[model samples]
Target: MKIFDTLNTFMLEKVKPLAFRFENQPHIVAIKNGFIVLLPFLIIGSFMMILLIPPYPEDTTSGFGQAWLALAKELSEPLWRVFQMSFNAISLFACASISFYLAKEYKITPLHTAVLSMMAFLLLCMPYQNSSADITYFGGKGLFVAIFIAFYVTELKRFILRCNLSIKMPKEIPVAVAQSFNTLIPILAVLLTIYPFALLIEHYFQASVPVVFEQFLAPVVQASDSLYTLLILTALIHLLWFFGINGALIFIQLWTPFLLVNLGENLKAFQAGEPLPFVITNGFWDFYVTHGGSGGLISLCILLVLFSKSKLCKNIGRVGIVPVCFSIAEPIIYGLPILLNPIFLVPLLLAPLVNGALAYFAHSLELVPAMVILVPWTTPAPIGAYIASGGSVSAAVLSVLLIILDALIYYPFFRLYDKICQEKEANGKEITQ
Candidate 1:
């Protein structure tokens, strides 16, 4: 208890403040909002991709699967194009959104800044080789570079504005017109700066901007393949939640690019009928590690409804059960008030790691294949697992097994908390009597 008390003090007094600061940082805030804005497109794209894929892995172009493949192609080909158009253009959208949001924070001309920044990004990606645009860089492969340009272009615009390089119009002119003119110099400056550098790299190094930048980010992307790294990140996420912070916002930055790259690779390999190349990905996190929402809130909610003696726990859990089935856990987090609650602290922090470790080992042993499809986070656990692993019953079974184990891990702590709550209620009743 003393150790728990000390740790709690450290978390509240030190960790909480740091988490809040990170959450409030300008760039972090922009990235978080930008990702939120991009999520609908990614979700739509993932759905379309799933539609294009045959549910059974054994289904191929020949034999009994032929008719199914033809039907799938007919239904999903056009939609697949739609998916490609959106998901492959993530870098373009990421640059625009990040610039737009960051510019908003800076009290600048957001639309103009966004456009300018996007233009800067295009300039960096210049000199397309093929008759059709070389779109490889427009996808997840180019996200790191997109982030760089978003900040660089916006900052350059800020610098230009600060230096009074932008046009200053007469006081009587319309504010809109004045603002438009004011953006001109900044836009030109961004283009001039980025275009030449891009040209120089192309001429001298014989590599595109994205190619050059990808090398720099390769290490960061490679780190996610490590189980220890994944576990640490998993732990950090629930730790933040325990302190009442939205962990997803902070950790998604670490998860998104690596997951995106792995998903892209998996999609390519799956199309070629090759085995998946990576075991860890965003899909693994979604469908395996943190299934039933962060910290196994699904298990906690079930226990609350079925076993809790407290009226408050039972009511919250009963209402929360359906949401938890779909991997939504905010109701339990706040309604049952897991955040900042000492009884929940250990289980909340430990549950994700326990789940992640078992899942990682299962994957390492090839007991379950790497998930190719990026299933929606809200999908039910077994169904999501089945789809994500591309029709693996073993994977779905693993999901159920994990839930049971998570429930076990959480049960004792919940019982203890429930007992304490019951005692408090009894004391109150005695006093009233």
Candidate 2:
């Protein structure tokens, strides 16, 4: 009880304010919004990836699976093309999207700013010789570079505007030409500042900007993939949620780059028929650890709907059932008013932690393939599991298993909470609103 009191004090006095500021910070906001704009493109690429390797096993006897595999083989070239253009160009899209949103946030010209960001990104990451350079940096590997470029361009533009650093054409010059002159300073600034670093890195280290960044950050990336890291992240997000903060979205900002890079690596290995190089990815977090939303709220909704005796409890469950199926947690969190609710706290922290451990070990032991495809988080967990696993029956079954386990974890907690609701209802305190 004393520990809870101490924690409650610390959360309210310390972590809560920091979480709110982080959730609302402009750069972080831009990052979240930027990713939203590109979700459809990633989904399309992942769909193509799944088609490249038929979900059915290589030894499958299913007639439909065999026919599909044949068709996939026939269209392999086209499939690879689409996948390469979209998913493989993740960092490029990320640079553009983040810069565009950040520019808008600062009341600048978003379209032109986004283009400038890409221009700088390419100058550093691309090889000098036209045909010799592989596009290794254009994908998830270049993500950090893309982020830096996005910030650099937008902030540079902001500084130029602040210092009145544009080339002003005479009044008689064409309006379009005058607008074009505005971009000259940023372009030159890019060449003068970032271009030198790119050249130096190449000349001395024989590496591109993205490569150096990836190498510098490599150890951190590898560490983030472990079960311990996953559990800590899971706990942090759920803990914040218990106090009425948007912990999931907040953590997503920090985790997205790592998740995207891992997903890219896995995609490459899967395409080459090599072992998947990662155990952590968007699919792992979305479908396995946080299925039905963070903290396994989907499991709680099922318990509320099927078993609660309280009318208010059952109705709340009915309302939340659909959203949680799609991996949204708002309906249950707000409806059940789980925020600051002591009875629900233990299950809130424990369920997803259990799920994360299960998923990490399951994939580690090779009971199922590590996820290659990056399915949308909103996809129902069971369906996302099968698709993300490239049709692994065991992975699909594992998803169901996790959800059941989550429900079992919540069963006693939900029963205790529901009894209170039942008693309150008898006293005409039926928990409405």
Which structure among the candidates has the greatest lDDT? Answer: 2
lDDT of 2: 0.89
Model 1 lDDT per residue over 23-94, tens place: 888888788788778878876776677667766444455664666566677887688788777876788899
Q: Which segments of model 2 are wrong by more than 4 Å? A: 1-10, 56-60, 130-133, 169-177, 430-433
Cα lDDT of model 2 by residue, 223-246, tens digit: 879888898889989999998878
What TM-score fits each model?
Answer: 0.90, 0.94
Q: Model 1: clashing residue pairs?
A: none
Candidate 2 lowest-lDDT run of ten: 126-135
Model 1, CA-based lDDT: 0.81
lDDT of 2 at 107: 85
Candidate 2 residue pairs that clash? none
